[model samples]
Target: MKNKLLLLMCILVFTTGCKKDFLVQEPLASFSDQDFWTSEASVRAFAMGYYKERFPGFGVNDVGGVFSIRETLNDDYASVSLPGFPSQPTVSGGGWATYFSDIRKDNIFVDRVSGMGMKLGDSATYKHWVGIARFFRAMDYCDFVFDYGDVPYYNRPLTDYDTALFRPRDPATFVLDKVLEDYTYAAQNVKLDDPGTGPRGLVITRDVVDAFMSRQLLYAGTKLKYDPATSAADRVKAGVYLQAAKDAAARLISSGRYAVADNYQKLCSTIDIGATPAVNKEMILYRRYNTGEVTHAIASGNNVNTIQGNGAPKDLVDAYLCTNGMPIKTTAGVNPAYLGDQTAANQLANRDPRLTNTFRTDRFYLQYIETGYSVTGYKCYKFLDEPTQNEAYAVQSFNITDAPIIRFGEVLLNYIEAAAELADMGTYTVVQSDLDKTINVLRKRAGYTAASRLPDMKIIGNLPAVGATVYDDADRDPSVPSLIWEIRRERRLELVYEGFRENDLKRWRKINYYNTQLYPKKNLGAWITKSSVTKALILADINGNVTSPSNTATGSGYLKVSQTFRNATSGFVVDRNYLLCVPTYQIDFYGRNGSTLTQNPGW
Candidate 1:
């Protein structure tokens, strides 16, 4: 009887295993599936891992460095490679690999969540987690489609023994459909406001999802490939998605959850490293960074003397409308003398205050005075962190600032553009009230006393002539309306240093307009000196009041120094080769599986 009881006990133990609840496991190596996904905390941790997979370094050649790609694609930023500059790729290998890796991790998380059974917690938590997963999946796919075009769709992770390791590329439309499906799911299931978290604009709130949807739809609607041969229904579908995006943005604006920061200086001045809360309302979605964890060394030029020297190009500087809401040409044409002076004080004077926030002018000084770095022509002021510096590289110190991925301001603009595009289809000319709200909000942030009325066709036709009289109409393409062009121009100016211009140029098919041969010819002017006697004296004062003799002498001498000359625009013509080709290694890998992915034409 005793032996029988012992056997029975052993059987029971074998059937119902002992619970392992407190085990810590290292990721990316090996772990038991049953041991991992058993609780809400575990699931949340897995989601964080997905986010970690997507985070790139802050180095100049990393994704943070890609921030300059937009500047390069536009006529706004230029680069001079020296020691420590990472190998420059014809296409961004780091960006490509990081995004693809992000997709892989997101796929793994989605698969894991689907199979796991939740029993202990609220069902809503599980649903919210799933919604967040889908949101990330859609975001990763959107990045891939926009940058690399249609890529292989891997909704699940591959097994080691699976012979189908390689896959064929899907159509861009198919990928877009996947993005829409995920976003739609996220919008429907995710709570508008997560419980206990309050209405934090920094997190993945319902509004952000909607804004992303609008961005995606607008991108699809404008692409020429989505026309007739692709499908008659695509255009209509595009309109629908865009409309949904617009509605979502309008809802957020109405909800009063966010407002543009009060002043242009506030936008730039909020780079304080010691602040208790690093994020501001102006930031929608941003990656948080701390000192020693990651750094923007290359972009900040190793923080040499707190001067990164990553300067913005003159063409972008000229893009900002004068403070009077008139084109630069309106002012420049009236006084050619001001045309040669691109100093922050000269070029930015009487212009949109956003210009000063985005680009450093001679008038603005670095918070650290000893560096004496002034804007040579126009320089980027958006990413500088003057308060924090790595002691080793005084200029290279990594500030604990958050890098914003999306902003509400962008959503407003997206809504206005999309609604205007769809106006005739549903609403006549998209309501002027909606357009005004978007523009006026941004103008207010820039300290504009009042908003201007939308320009009519005749007013647009009279936009100051750029390049030659032949190109005047080119600048004022009435098919899209002059007001729309103005909005786009504002976006170019406001979003200059952020990583959007390159993709924006591709999507709009307007690379030819800015990247023409006439760019160099049109921009022949001497570099504007950014020195002033008062600023020089201030720079010399190490103790905040007493001027250093050396600095005072340099400041006095600089007033007499001749202005330096530098060509602010490139001569490169936008040809078929403007888009990057698939790297040879990727093509080689895909070719083994009987899949032939063609390179971009002329590449």
Candidate 2:
């Protein structure tokens, strides 16, 4: 009887094709709304997926691509293929496509939850989930709009097979409107404080929504092409949105929910990976990388002393201000403190303490097999996980550090910059006051004694002799409105290697200014000189005595008897071609059915 029963069950399973369906399931396939998003756990899981898509790693894997491209602007690493030529490189469409894919999933979640009548516990919880989804959707759209100019906007799951599958690009303004709409919804629905008492960084809080709205409004107000096509009133609308962003930031700052970390180095190393949330007050929205998951080491390698060449560029090293909140070049002749023979200890002397914490200068060392590992140029130390973690693999070396997507400090800077720009346009003149507040806070937290006093131009006399010409007003006192330039200089320094330079340059319309062949040519000399080794010691006998020789091996291993390493400079100037061309592959794939897309000019 048992044998007969088992035979019958096997037959039924075979008829159902259960084993085949289970074995051949497509990896990319997702469940229907009916199968997913029926419970609060499922909703939380959906939120996790969105975070995962946005922050793929703590280090250099898929997440590294997003971070690396942004740092490309100010000098972290030069494009090897382009040599010394500054060019705009398109982020391969993978990030954009992945973001859209996640947005589609988020939309599906929203639709499912709205229809399922599943108890999301309470009205606040339900609205919060919806708000979170919308926030991510807005963020994803913002990324698309910033990079590609215009993209199709999808708010909900597709129902019409034909139209849904073949939607065309909307106007850039239309896309911005959609982003604003979603952010407005999120800001309205989400609570400034957590209702469910979830971990501060786990779910989208009211502060996160506000930060997103602030950033969106600032971008909309700044990008000229996205400004409304109406009359002069459009300019007023831009200012209004910018002012709103400032107000949001102001409210958050007043709430005292966040503060700058006490030690700048502690902020990057300890705060990034330390037990207990490191300074959550400043972090408006951060994606947490658990012990064994994502890490920063993968994105920017910590294996700098080895064959891995993941150090940051001289431009970034040069950006750090000396003790008195002045650019290093304002003090150190063009030689800059952190490069070449300047030992890490001396290079980091009297500089922004954050530089030492955020980057691996020649002075910092990692524990290697027997001896310590050290390198020349600084390696990005922010977001890197300590080697002790299980996630630090032999092959991958992924540092599992949580990545901050949005923070109060950034919001403060945005508010200050927006306010300053508006003040420039005759809206207000307290711009210097706004800037001082933010800079003072960061400097104080960095533990430098000089934070209490601004640098006196008379004390320093003229600017440091080297690279002074790069500053247009080299002769002008470092105070005045020319000090506003210093604000940007401070932003570049304070936020070095954090992946903001490229976008900042783009918005300022300063891409042409820095993208020229001349700056890169002048900059390449520092990079090549600093990267080359000066001497090597060899074991001479069984005794501990060693013989030393001046090594003249070039990076290519060719003997360099006389010639100094020189990088080729592109003589051509940057023009409209400086903007990246949307990848040709994307156009070809989507151009069917009257979906032709325009490429950036001069590609």
Clashes (N, CA, C under 3 Å) per candidate: 9, 15
Tens-digit lDDT track for model 1 on 246-282? 7767776787866665544434334431242323666
Candidate 2 Cα misplacement greater than 4 A, ranges: 1-32, 57-74, 78-96, 116-118, 164-167, 193-197, 225-237, 271-278, 290-300, 303-314, 328-348, 359-398, 431-433, 450-483, 513-516, 521-596
lDDT, candidates in the order shown: 0.53, 0.54
- Give lDDT tens digits, candidate 2, residues 433-536: 46446665665663545543334221112122112333323322333355446557657666655677656755555554443232332122122221234333
Worst 10 residues of 2 by lDDT: 557-566
